[model samples]
Target: MNNKLIRQAQEALIVLGYLSGTADGKFDKSTQDAVLRFRRAEGLKRTNIISQPLMPYFEAATLKKLQTNLKTLGYANGVTGKLDKATIAAIKTYQKNNKLRQSGEYSHVLLAKTNRAAREREQARNRRAPVSVQNNIGTSSRSNDVVISSRNIPSQSNSSKASAMPNLNNRTVQENEIMRSEPNTAIQGKMRILKGSNGQVTGCKISTITISSDWCTSGNNKEGSQCNVLYKNGRVLSVRCR
Candidate 1:
């Protein structure tokens, strides 16, 4: 028997919530029951055997379901339907916070534990005082205070007030002019370019700040290239040849 194939099948089953324990590559009774459940769900032959051709089906289904669950639990931002770097990072963070093994991989145990945590948090929130009751209490307290009329209040002369207030419009225009005149000096020197798994230039890092691909416009930039980085809003915006 191919232990590797069995392990993969077990992991897929665990991710789909059919199994509850770790995938130990052993065809135990629990694994067999999980496989039987999965077969019934997919309308396949009611057998516990995981064939070589069934690997792709299991992988695709498991990844999509895992991504959906991770996103719903707030562990991931968006579901790209693929196991990308962001998804792995979210998984690792979730596992670390939950005191799990921190494997940064998907499993039924992780999902089940996270679901329970979410339910506990929701119950705790529901036990708190409602916002409407707090607002009513504040309103009741303020009702006993005296009301003041704007017409009875003293007012300053328009001429005096106009002279004291500075020309805010002109000041704003001057500040904008100064900002436009200033040179872009967020990144003074060259920084190292970074790439993704597809060998495309994604972003760069200077010192300690790591810029992401969304903030970078990599025009003819390559990985490991020392390029002049344009910075904006506390991030690297673009990379160009000096």
Candidate 2:
């Protein structure tokens, strides 16, 4: 699909709660479901029509429904209920799976994919995992997407090691100046860029992001040796160097 349409579809989905990444205008499954779910609930045909294909017949209500969903999902930050950045990020995550769009817009194909993934995710969650002692080490929720090895880790550490961990509490706060303001703003820690399983943490900008959990590395928006995520306080938390 065209980039603009893809972004529109993705934006519509994020406005609905079915996503968790920046809308970069790629039509993925997450976007697809956003369209379908909104349509079905509104008593409309559950099809991919959040685009030129659907036209005026399903445009207005669909957009409204999408916004409503986004608010319901906590992604819609503003009370205005407009499809903003938060909504777009949440939607972009869904599109990641279907391999469609990611430009933070709304479209047809993305709507379809989004709907399908949600249903599948629900089903999978409901299904019981096979009983086995085999290690199925899932990634950490806190470390963005980088997988750290807790395996064989010594539970007991000397005071020196504990003290070695960087303390972010002393960080210089510059709220008025505003850093990490843009979506896809790179995350950097002591070592490098922090990346999620998908790649790097690319999503909405939060007013406050405390580095409570220590990050040796970080995440960024582009491929580079130098960090893309520069801190106003001169601290590079972590950089997303691909």
Candidate 3:
């Protein structure tokens, strides 16, 4: 058995709150018990060995837990199991704040550090007591009086009508042209339109990734009509009707 693999597994288990001892690169009984528990939780066959096939599962589980912790700590906005762009950004921010290397990658060491920080924060919160605020405003016996003077306010109906009219001048047209010339709109315009088997406009297929009608509906395009969607690097940037 590779001691390095065992040590990595132990570190993952520790971050996942399955083990308590140090990861000393030894397949000890404690490590075996932790591995068993993890396996059970993952619904994998009962095994104490950290094989090559099982390593990826451990890494994925550890990453999910780390993402959850970061979300709870306000470092991440969502708990995505994969290391997508948002996850990378969150990891980079967290590393920068903690004075660690901003590699934007996951490792057992990073997971352990994040887990420790979360535990410390939880303990500190538990140690604090709830504070109660008391309102002690005394009643005043002074008479409060107010007087209002009415003044004749002039309203020009011509000015109100002019203000309510829509502006169709050159500046408004220029602003609309500039908005249409944006890079996102240009990209969407350039995307190849896709159709379903029935010849109705369904969605788009950029490279190997497919943006289906469900994604369009999720973006408030409930009709799933002819829509332009901007997608890049496994993320949907924008969705709008053509």
Candidate 4:
């Protein structure tokens, strides 16, 4: 088979969450492992060898995996391989939820965001660990109970809104206060509060929030105007409120 086909298969495996490394057209160990995982997930024979018939399966599997991820992120998109209205609508809904543009187009960036959301949700659910017999003696049973919240349940919000996070690579923020609490580990770089057309902080970006040690020249970064406020500790957020 052509190396291009292998690269395509690699990209599909990536969309299905079976691969992590880049699709460099080389059938390396990571690519082989991803192929094995994809085959297992699709109920095919567990092998690293790519075949002609399996080519179509790669694309279908990618779409289905994306649909699964979208569902996990609280969108009710259908799992059809075709670019149906339902899937596009779900993409738009996801974009709106993440304060992104409602282009209704599938991109690797959007896939990444959905994957992160799914992983975060999975982590949150995992935090409610099963109760242990040893701890049952000293404390109330309710204290050890695993309570799952419905905060992540999907909603059918309007996807027509034109809200999006500013390109963080191109923009930066001026800060006002230094955070005292431990920062959210997931949140990194400089955080900026994004404002909507009405001048309200509709969303926020994880852009470079420059921190300076000197009191007199704190806002003197070469990137742009800087803020003296430090945000070492603050609430970790995916986006600000609407």
lDDT scores of the candidates, listed in order = 0.52, 0.42, 0.56, 0.51
Worst 10 residues of 4 by lDDT: 210-219
Judged by whole-model lDDT over C-alpha atoms, candidate 1 comes out at: 0.52
Cα-based TM-score, every candidate: 0.39, 0.28, 0.52, 0.47
lDDT of 4 by residue, 135-232 (tens): 11222234432222212222223442234222333332222222222232332443444434432222223333211111111112111223233321
Model 4 scores a TM of 0.47
| Cα lDDT tens digits for candidate 2, 42-121 | 67777865667654434554444544333322223223234466657756654554465667775544444544543453
lDDT of 1 by residue, 187-239 (tens): 43345555555333344554333444322322333334455655432223344
Off by over 4 Å in 2: 1-81, 130-242
lDDT comparison, 2 vs 4, better candidate:
4
| lDDT, residue 154, candidate 3 | 27
Clashing residue pairs in all predictions, respectively, total: 0, 64, 0, 1
Stretches off by above 4 angstroms in model 1 are: 43-45, 75-80, 84-242
The candidate 1 region of ten consecutive residues with least summed lDDT is: 172-181
lDDT string, candidate 3, 1-242, tens digits: 79888888887888788999788999889999899999999999998877878888887898888887665455554565899997887788788878899899988788878878777755644443211111111122322211111122222334345433232231211100001112332233323335454333344433222343323322224332455655332224455653
Best by lDDT: 3
lDDT of 3: 0.56
- Give the better candidate number (2 or 3) by TM-score: 3
